[model samples]
Target: MARRGTLALGRHLARRRLLQLGVLTAAAASLTTEAWSSTSTTAAPRFSEYPFSLGVASGDPAPDGMVLWTRLAPEPLAEDGLGGMPNRPVPVQFEVAEDDNFRRVVRRGTVVARPELAHSVHVELHGLRPGREYFYRFRVGRVESPVGRTRTLPPTGAPVGMLTLAFASCQRWSEGFYTAYRHMAEEDVDLVFHLGDYIYEDPINPTSNARQQTVPDYFQVEAITLPRYRTQYALYKMDPDLQAAHAAHPWVVTIDDHDVDDSWAADVPKENSPTPTREEWLARRAAAFQAFYEHQPVRLVSKPSGPDMQLYRRFAYGDLAEFSVLDTRQFRSDQACGDGRVIGCEDRLDPTRTMLGEEQERWLLDGLARSRAQWNVLAQQVFFCQRDFEEGPEQRFGMDEWSGYEPARARVIEGFRRTSNPVVLTGDVHVHAAAEVKSDFNDPTSETLAVEFATTSISSGGDGADVTPATLIRLKENPHLKFENQQRGYAVCTVTRRSWRTDFKILPYVVTPGAPISVRASYVTEAGRPGLQEA
Candidate 1:
């Protein structure tokens, strides 16, 4: 009866998660300001080092408020991944003020940072005004965290004349410095979208690191255990530039292949040495997901329940735009044709293959149909459009992304018709590109269904050249692909009622500490139009 009751409870939770589409409205995320019962207020505990080493962040913003995140990490690189915190819950205080100086305090609260969650705090707030900027910080005893800036979305269906945002992905710490993020921190954007590969799971070589920084021996092995994953996140989060970017804007994030493993699909792990059994893989996945949640600014709704976590959700920014952030990795079928670049593979065309599971696909289409926003955006990982690798009649495509799931790609393209203007923002290709989503890739003149702006990496491929020989060939092969550049950078978009303009921001070098950023190219899609044009 206990097992049956647990099964029933799991079914109930699944139903609840399925019903939650636009989580901003569906999830009751607000946390009470009352002190947590577990928190002790007798005396403030002291640490030998600063507790806010990992820094503060806010994300998943709504009209009323956003989730404020901070982890107490005095000894950030502790092997146990506990951040040197004692095995108990510590009382943490939070303050939301209208100004950075805390002169106009709006909301205040006390929450407990539990050792189970690596002494992390996610303060979900509400009752604040819409379409306004707010400053927030965490306090542990007399030590206060750095002031982080965040903003709430405008009211639902409210008239928003303009919205500016930046999207970035694929920052491998050992490869290069976070110079792009340092520049991104200065951008006057309202939001930031991190389309995954946030942390590379592979082992980092201390001697061969591009940044010439000292890496601990713990990172010499792949992050498989809970503590290893936590330490990996700490290493990435320890970057001041990354912290600055997080502090500057409210980020909406989703993971890709590197967040877990290379080209892992559904319950399947990638082919490699010392392959683990299915059960072991799930445990590793749970650890990775848990560590991801503890470090990110995502809400409680995103907390992982074992190997599964509810990550795919929608967010609306007034009547101007709506974003449907996707989780392509968690629910996708195993890659077809052996999961690599392949030609003449009929398995890719199998109608049963799915990029997003049937449920998420349904949710996406339904959301598109019901959306009243002027611009509907699919902020997701992986390339959405087709790309033929070799410049010849015999075409080969990467099997890991949408190109491998042809039927599923077609269905999503068909769903684009439900909205007025459809735009796809993609990552993980490590090359900046602007492509028109054609109804049929075989024919170059096929009607444009949507436009895709794929941003380059933050620092994944170090010191990328401008327009490599392969890039030129790819652009020539795929005419639908307008522009392609092998550079480390991000894409910034300015959305208005009339048009949405994207600036491909590029950095010359990331191996070095400071590199100047510039716009490589700019594309604009006018309202009611679905193709890209020079801005």
Candidate 2:
């Protein structure tokens, strides 16, 4: 284990050195020019299989434009993790139009997909009309990829009537089918927010796995290297349902613990028995972040720099809504009281202990204070309101969630008071929860500062039940918690100037290939009113 850690650290340091020397940049430039100059590459490179097998996507929409993404994965599940691409860079062309047929071509450009970046293309575009829907596609040789739909956000502070969106998270491919995503793709929404656990880093057991799809033997081991992480992403991206969700709408994403490792904290590995050093963990984090960026339809600004990636960002849908997407796992202090569920952990209430770190906290608070939007949305992971696991006077809470960082949670609650209608869209917990964020958790009658709708998982657990004994206990303990459901699904939200309504879309079963979806519960909060009411 020590030897492996040392080797991983060595590889990471070597890459850092090359980056500092600008060798990687210079080599990439030379390769790109050479690739473009090659007669075969410039003309039409032939391929045995369709290159865009993983499908196309767009995300991070602004008033002007959005980021377009596609990976040239002729053999998506190839163990090598290069997506069966050649060693050289490949030129990928993209086109955006007002219609799906491309009759009204608006933007056309070419980008180089280098082997070092897993033959992925992220085309950041601009100069587009605000609040307009556009259709985009990619071309390689004579093959044209699937046409994807994307919409630009309304002009900043512009009066908009309504904004429709769906938020989902925690889709463990090996555990269950991605049937919820198929339903989500069919929803008429302007945006989709993925609040983390995009890919599980744990090893797979196909024989026992719910999906029972054939996979490489190497997938039985945890993802630690760049190639391993890339391969894991490839496996997940190969799902048609997931691809449909990405193609159907633009997504705003943030990372959670499962994206890298199960319950991993900043610079701290969850497995401490054969504990990895900080350097080793950072190296692993870098690999995970790189794979995440390569796979997602995110902008270049989110590209990982070693272990760090700047993912926390804000988006405005005119003056109607403002989204404060947060990265809770990246810069957080290690879980207090040694992590996990606990009680009487004094370390949790420490004023200096933070969940967003000092910088992101300041940014969130500042953005909340300065925002003019009618709805201030915190698109994030984990339960934002107090969730007491223990039923009676014990007062047990999850150390890994906001409940463990009471002071930090309190500060954010104060920020919620500054906004018109603060709504928190959360994931991470497998069960759906609708709660009213109170100014004081100890007193139920205290002012309700905001409302939270924590969506259930896409498939993480097998087929979940509608309710369990644990669910009843949780509701009994937390009076502010209005509802709870243990079903695999997502949340569809419609935001207007007057009110915000969230419908919890649930799937009865995800163990099989197809499952019908239904709205199990619905909650709405009015403008200038923070608490949730049955819709």
Candidate 3:
């Protein structure tokens, strides 16, 4: 009976997720938020506390629908886990409009902001026209959230004219201000992809921080408990620039290390330590996952199932491109050779040590084989191509990357070889790099299977110089490498049927709030060509 009951619950949750995809099945031309006024707090003061301090966000866009997200945090930086809302469930109303002023409101719905889920709302609006723009907002009593703009994707297997996409990663609060995100908000782009390290795991060193932003005292320690993780996200989300980027466009995000702990594998804790035990580590991971889901504007599919969330999924932009967003931290083998720069480690040569694991590896390869999109991209964290740090005949590789698992990398390369146009979009290196990914990294003359464009960090490391001496040496050592830059910025991709162009946009200084952003370099790869060319 217990097992049967559990199965029934599982079925219910699965149906709930499926329902999110088609929630706006029957939409009224002009819906009203009047229905929610009954449940709203009537006696509350007019200006007791403004709840929308953390701002509003939306993400995970699909052809039919996208997720609209906002959490009711009356006092955002409260010491306790609660966002200063009462213990009871709050009624939150949402509106979707064709115009920014809400003059042409199309969809309106009321959803309960439950206490268990941190008084947040994830309104998945479906049944809308494909490739269309929409504005959304949330209302709780008299307070209203800022209106956010978002757009849906083109229909499946359909061709798009052109796509302006930007990707970035690694935003450490203490390192610098979020000037890159501020710049990104002003760009004319359809969507954004944050490929991980969205929030650093370590606490902010306030004394050393140049930016005068106030990080709450609660987040001064590394996040471990549920409250700590939630607090960390709240503090980061309070930044106006980060909120601006979220409000401007829908984001597709995945987390690397720092969201939970540093360099955490499937169930292994940071630093390869087994002190916490598997069960304890999973519990901690569950808290982190729940906190992540609560804050971000992600789809219901990636919602936490205990410690595990289904983050590795595919997003299609008509027939022009297909983004196979992967989760490298989950289901990956531990770093080989003591987890550092190792020279010729035979342990890395073991084919059995999987990076994407058996399930995700099979899913990725099968998806690549069946995809009809012109450009098939691996939107994921970590470096896809091998990076040998030391300049010598005895090659050295970063143990944390795909280089540590050669056979798995070879499998991915072979799969890419069979595709139409394979491109890898990577982050977590904290520096801009472009490379020709060969089927076999041991032999550069071997067939080039894919081209990789790695974006630099957003504010993880402080302001960076254009080119360091070490970068020059590494570029010389790796002959197949095309470009390298040590600058804080993002990579913008302009995609068409004929070619894909990537511009490495850089910020000279991030230690201050208003730094000038410029294009450091630009590269393009023509159709049928797997290597990069200077634009």
Candidate 4:
């Protein structure tokens, strides 16, 4: 059940006054009218006030357990504002049941939501039966969260019957509603993977969305301060559909460029203009990461320290599937500029350039070599296909993707070939695509290493400004490319022991609020066959 209410500012002010008198704290004097203005504006609902403002969610499902999360906000924005709510810790109880009614409760436990953690609660449940479905919900005071369904992974080496998962990315708040998330919520999936650009870099200009406000610094623009970032995440989390999806299944998420800054590399700034100094940039990065952790259903292992967080990790669904989630942004050479086109930038082709960094690369390769799962799913951001913009030489576009780092791309492909994996799940081109990853695309007879399935954005922009028929012509010049659709929506993958099918779900239009969704295309790759075919 969803909680509803309004917070009166006068009541909060009175409470603050009493607390100040009782403690005789001089700091309480700083809680002036101006400080409370934002909180008092209209009694805006916050995660703490609603207890599920960021919505109920679960993630990182293992064979025996999954992580459940929610923030308890009894008063989202107190008199001091900042959405900090009460300073005291609150007790939150989570319930897991075999049925939606929750009458047959199988698991129940209490976890403390502390102020130090912004009143956020993360309860990791373990020792559950394998390959079983369960429904869960959190409760605090009189409030009950939306019921979410989650499942544990099957036993290792077990011949699992089937598995279904959805992949999506690039959800610009200003573009439109997350109809794709709504569709996914209604889906009976085992898991969900958000492959980055969960939030856009640019601020939501008023023109983009009638409800948006114009702000400066588009990429690092919207979420400058901690409060702003929290508000932004809260705004996105308020989407009922996205909430429903989070409630429906355990999600695996990884951040890409937009989450921090657009096309940001290891220590390099996006705009190249000398505005915020390096120290200021680092501080901003730290703030962004803290906000990200507060909003997402990630483990404490992903907690931010200053401006860095260890985000690359793996999750297994028994022998049926194993996901190698990657972090492409935190450790990569700066984007090549100066050559006019986004891709022709000379530094991109440098062999020393890396996307996953050396340590993570070795970890990935080793994991692939050691895994015995039937499907070795490389759940990651950006396309793994060699995206070249030329019929021959002297033609190219942006080098931010795998196309920019040829050596790294080749190493990944060669690793796949050596390991003989089944498929690679990808997102972040803001377009639907399918490709046959080969060890050597220049050699038509080269062995296909693994199949690549890339989903379009949830709602970014229509085909983007750069993608055109001319661009497609240039893209086709690369032999490994198989299919492409510059559209919006998500990719749903249905996996069996011998084959994996993909349904590329596309929305009518991202610009249109509440657009209808449809299955625009479908493809499949059979076991041992490392390329996609129309389903």
Candidate 5:
């Protein structure tokens, strides 16, 4: 391991050497070009190469509007996060159409692409009809971006037939090919929810056993600054399959620990780490949030203010379902007992310990009680249900998950009981899981109040197997866990007035490309039921 680490460090230094030359060249050219850009008479940059390399995306769907996003990057891997744009703002025209051919154009407008935000545009489109699909595209003079498809959520307090939504999380670029997203692009889902770990902060090491070094010297060092964070998003977004997924469906997203720093809970970071002070960490967090908003289709209302961003919000899909997306980081309490899996830890059982924080917890509970939809889905990152890793005399639990916070979990479970049909959609575990939310997890006879469906990773853990040793052990120990699988894929949810069904979509291999997709299992919950029942 030491030898591999040294070799990786050597490669990174070589990459930095190459980037220095490019940076110097860019710096020399920018001195002249940027000065021209400072004047009001400045025009667009001279682009001999295609600038729409990052592609276009639409997300944060509402009843009448959605957020459209894009960035111009003629040179993607330029070391600088400027995306090869001028210093001044550029005019970008966007249009939304009822049809793919734009014969029935509905809305058209122009927005400025500012250099302050890496020349990215987030056009929050409004005044459109609900429960309808729309095609949108961007243009800059003669150059045109690829057309993207998006849809608004169904009308509230209305009886909708059904909703087909796809959700997944944890897509590490080095793990495997994003062939799962390639398949998801072809799926007929109305919406997609990405529950964080959007990008990993660790340096890429090819000799690592977990995943192959797919893109080496690609921002190889850990991301701490704004430029590094922005560049990371650019690198990940370069995948055609990911771009296809974004173009295909509107997405609702929230970050996990990996988005900023790994295993970082609330204000406190992991024990024995290199982050010097809280101020520095907040700066790192601020950089991460700015880059996230700049690239994603998230709503403008949730924009970051320094170190914080209001990501936890609610969206209704008519009377069929309502999604309450939560942010597990930021205001959350630090993981009890100094993080990681622990057996018999007293800190984890503290009543004051919280996973959703006080404010978000209140908001979520109130939203669940007030929702008119038949299904109230708590969409967020990390596992919500309790899971004991070991069997018999000793009980081991992960502090990173809800299992560590007993009081918080109990309150959330009680809140679900107050709703019509509550369901928790989770990620960050890197494996598929279906479980029953017990009022009292220790008591076998305790009431099952709600249900949870933990979605698997996209390509984070490489080509995962259908049945792994960890899955078998966990299932044997925990009876409430109905199903689980270690596979590289996403989850397809079909919600209706009668029932909420989840299809565990699995791709056995994502090491190369074009792995055959299949449904590993199907589970359902009746309109008023809370526990899992095989469909």
Candidate 6:
């Protein structure tokens, strides 16, 4: 009779556990359905799958540490709309090694992936030696993440020899494969810089075949909610090439307009539209910002809170390079017109109007002046060229860019001139271009202050646009512009004590998968000679 009772109790406990699993599965199913419809191809696959949809990444490396990130979502979409992951914290272990073999282990730790934060984990490792390369990977239970290689910035005041850095932006996943990232991964770069537009907020509309489409829109056509934002990021993070690139090196990231919305100016609600209120927009922005942080390998300083994330920061690579990353979307005045057209829009040209805000601008200028590094790299978004629309006196089109904010642009140029060691690295405009930055674009003989290299999009709008002629016309009008290529790819920059060489790689096409990539052009800026020259 005692043995019979023991067996009965064991059966009862088994039944209870089965009931719990049933409840959890039901809850996940409900959430998935509510979050997204199965009709959309972009809708995440059902939960309980292999190789988690969103890949893993690491970013924002300091002298002794870097941040590792990944999300846990077995079911991205369910009826209840909660992303299908159990609402429980899961333990994740991180291991870093000097070699890929995991033989010489250097750093190891464990962190909890809390479901309240979407089951994402961000482990910031510290106390490691400086200027060393390390391979790292994360694990939860029996599942292991892809192995990634990252390096810490060299110790301050250390005399560094040479550094290779690549910067690119504007990756619309559906538009094309991540050929740029594929190429970037193959390059032996020490660091990668993403200047923004990491993802587009707009849904893929069939009417506009201008950009490629990997998956259909999972959110509503008009606006995005928290779940929608999270799902979008999850979809983007699934790209293998992008994952490979992230696994290759630490990325320094800053957001551009499309990360929130197209042509979004500071604190300005959508023009002539009856949509969500300012508070609603703030909530949406907050959600988008949080999702971005959760997905990228950024540090804790950039954590999101209701549209408030301190994104502008600096990264120094010993005495070789100092990167001043900026935030241009948060504190600027509204665009002159809703369309980002209309130059000298009184509000745009206001001396008080700023792209980096007053505090950030001061910080940047101070950093530039005090920087002891051989190269001062300004990692920013948007074009720095005076991209005026007309070549001659016939007509001048006013578009949103550095040209729209003459006074603010002038201030940045003056700052570069004052420091005399600045190199402005920018993205956006979805086209590749390089220029000899001058204090004045209207004056051909104006003093050249520094140099600017603007990388094109990863896949946004495919390769060359039909406006190539107009682009060439504008280029011819501005003598400061050294070269321009309307292509899809990235710029690989090699910096040495004597010179900086930029190789602009162009992908054959973006609409089709597996597009071939080639070196479209190359430019070099020698020390003491600040302007760009054909390489």
Quick one: best lDDT, which candidate?
1
Candidates in order have lDDT scores of 0.87, 0.85, 0.81, 0.71, 0.81, 0.73
- lDDT by residue (5-102, candidate 4, tens digit) is 11224323322332233112312222222211122212222333445556677787777888888875444433222355656767776788776556
> Worst lDDT window (10 residues) for model 2?
27-36
Candidate 2 structure quality by residue, lDDT tens digits, 335-426: 89876889889999998888998899999999999999999989999888888889789999999999889999999999887777888999
**RMSD, every candidate, angstroms:** 10.6, 11.3, 9.6, 10.7, 10.4, 12.7
Order the candidate numbers by lDDT, best to worst.
1, 2, 3, 5, 6, 4
Superposition-based RMSD of candidate 2 using all C-alpha atoms, in angstroms: 11.3
Ranked by TM-score from best down, the candidates are 1, 2, 3, 5, 6, 4
RMSD of 6: 12.7
Name the regions of candidate 5 deviating beyond 4 angstroms.
1-42, 206-218
Question: How many residue pairs clash (N, CA or C atoms closer than 3 angstroms) in each of the candidate models, in the order given?
Answer: 0, 0, 1, 9, 0, 17
lDDT digits (tens) for residues 86-160 of candidate 1: 888888988887765566889888989999999999999999999888877777775667768788999999998
Q: Give lDDT tens digits, candidate 3, residues 1-535.
A: 4864574464344323222222221112123344333554563333345677677788899998899999888777777777787878777778887766566788888888887888888988899889877777777765567667788999998867677799999988888888888778766677899999988767776455768766666566777778877777887887777877787778999989778888778888877443268888898889889989999989889899999998998999999999999999889998888667899799999999989999999999999999989999999998888777887787888888888888898899889867889999999989998899876666778888789999999988789888888898778777677898988999899998989999999998998879899999899998888788899
Model 4 C-alpha RMSD to native: 10.7
What C-alpha lDDT does candidate 4 achieve relative to the native structure? Answer: 0.71
Which pairs clash in model 3? 158-319
TM-score on alpha carbons, each prediction: 0.92, 0.92, 0.91, 0.84, 0.90, 0.87
Over 4 Å off in model 4, which ranges? 1-49, 73-81, 206-221, 273-275, 338-346, 390-393, 462-471
Error of 4 at 446 (Å): 2.5
**lDDT for each residue of candidate 5 in 430-495, tens digit (9 for 90 to 100):** 998899888887775788888899989998888878887778888887878999999889999988
Q: How much is 453 displaced in model 6, in angstroms?
A: 0.6
